[model samples]
Target: MAKPIARKTSRGADRMETTLNNKVLTEIWGADQGVGLRVKQAALVVLGIAILAVAAKIKVPMWPVPITMGTFAVLSIGAAYGARLGLVTILGYMIVGAIGFDVFAGSSAEKFGLTYMMGGTGGYLVGYVLATFALGLLARRGWDRSFVWMALAMLIGNVLIYVPGLIWLGQLYGWDQPILQWGLTPFLIGDALKLVLAAVILPAVWSFVGKART
Candidate 1:
């Protein structure tokens, strides 16, 4: 009697997606799954706001200019948290600042709140939202998983931040003023270093996660 041949199923037939599409660090961690959707989102937003606050004050000693980790936090959180959550987190941070919380690097008790936000850093704040969205979007495409792609994503994110920042400085001060010197040139070294750091960190984190998963 001839036995019927058995068929071999495809590899990982029941496994989750192996590719990095639509999956971010937060989703992989599944921390939000422990609570309701709104609750998880709210908690993440609060956590993000706190992170931004702390990052705003952290200064790494470097050449030419000290590197503030605020922008780095903004970009990293956006990539890790995804677009919608990142946007809400940034808005929440802004609201906290607007209500006079001294949550900005350049703001103080005497000069905090809306008055401070509407000053020099206002345009950069707007850029924060845009750059967050851009980073989130790029992360969705798996750019955060590789050194080259993550570096490119960070570069794009920085550009998104700087363009509006420079424009705001020009409009706030004047075109004849040294807008480039005041807002762009001096910070290039710090930004470049941060960019390299981010490029290294994100990919390394992903690699660590990959190894842990196996």
Candidate 2:
């Protein structure tokens, strides 16, 4: 899994985790699945989900959609945690939201079931799962620490989200809605900015971790 390396400032719990994470970095990444986690591991998974949920609340209303730190949060978390944990964390968040916990962008799942999947933003939500997985791949390669790589990764992640989003939007709004009018017209600049933000943050995280190791 790829993610922004949270700066581990202390030497007890934080250092221990940092060290262990470093050691298992390869193993967690090498397998089709991630490295196995026991009880302690499960706890970390839940914690990651919580982190994303908290970030969601600190959002603004941006154009083309509700502006939120949710995507940035997920990308960073996925880059930090790797695929298995990243995926589990997001799914956990989704599961909680579906039960009507206000964890998603819009709050309320509207009955919360298969019906939600057929809704307007469902495809984008599904895309979150994918974006994180890809971020994990990059994180494993140690590109999580590289700015350029992170930018590219974030762009790809957004594209992955958008592809399904556009298709679903067309299905819902009809192809006559004018592609430029609803597809990417309002969000292109913002998407670029988000990509830049991810690039800056991911490398800073890598730098922080590298410095810590030293």
Candidate 3:
């Protein structure tokens, strides 16, 4: 009888731990609330897209590549919204940009739609979606629950953005262009700053959430 009771209690404790570990901030903020949740989620996605658009427009000019707040916004959205919603939000942003909306970084009246997407920055744009998805997966796994893990997750997402961006840039300009000088070296400091900022903000927000819940 004692052995059976002990085993049952252990199982119950394990389940409780799993439940606690799986609770992401998005769900904690009521994303799991049934019918109305869909509407709220849709709203969040739209908001995220808007944020990305705005971030894209804020650029620090550089040769070949410019620094933008877009990466920070992408990581934040992924951490705040979780995997499914983050993926949807990024995809929606890309769709809007592809359709000729002036939402992409440095987008102009002369450049819009699919034509603009296939431009030099196109690979980076696609990378945004992948990075968001990666970050969101980590967020779902509770990596966003603390500072260090969140920072590491965001850093990984940042690197994912660079990989495709560099490849596309290299393809476009060839070896003559010095791809590292154009694509990677210029943005390292900015990306590092963004990573630290995200790492601090997410854990701070989680702290607030914990207080609110209590």
Give per-residue lDDT, candidate 2, residue 39: 53
N/CA/C clash count, model 1: 0
Q: What lDDT is reached at residue 182 by model 3? A: 75
* Candidate 3 regions with alpha-carbon error over 4 angstroms: 1-20, 60-66
What TM-score does structure 3 among the candidates reach?
Answer: 0.86
List TM-scores for all candidates, in order: 0.90, 0.74, 0.86
Runs off by more than 4 Å, candidate 1: 1-10, 31-35
lDDT of 2 by residue, 72-171 (tens): 8878777777787788888888887776576665555454444565577777787888888888877776666678888888888888777887887888
User: Weakest 10 consecutive residues, lDDT, candidate 1?
Assistant: 1-10
Q: Arrange candidates by TM-score, highest first: which order?
A: 1, 3, 2
Q: Quote the lDDT for 54 in model 2.
A: 80
lDDT of 1 by residue, 1-214 (tens): 2332222222332244454456877777645455576687888899999999999999988777787999999999999888888888999999999999989989987899999999989999999999998898888889999989988999999999999999999999999998998899888888888888888998899888776764
lDDT of predicted model 1:
0.87
TM-score comparison, 1 vs 2, better candidate: 1
Comparing 1 with 2 on lDDT, the higher-scoring candidate is 1
lDDT, candidate 3, 1-214, per-residue tens: 9999999988977775566567656767655678889988988888999999999889876544567888899888888887889999999999999888999877899988899889788888878888888988898888887879988998899788889998998898886788888778878888887888898888888788655643
The candidate that wins on lDDT is 1
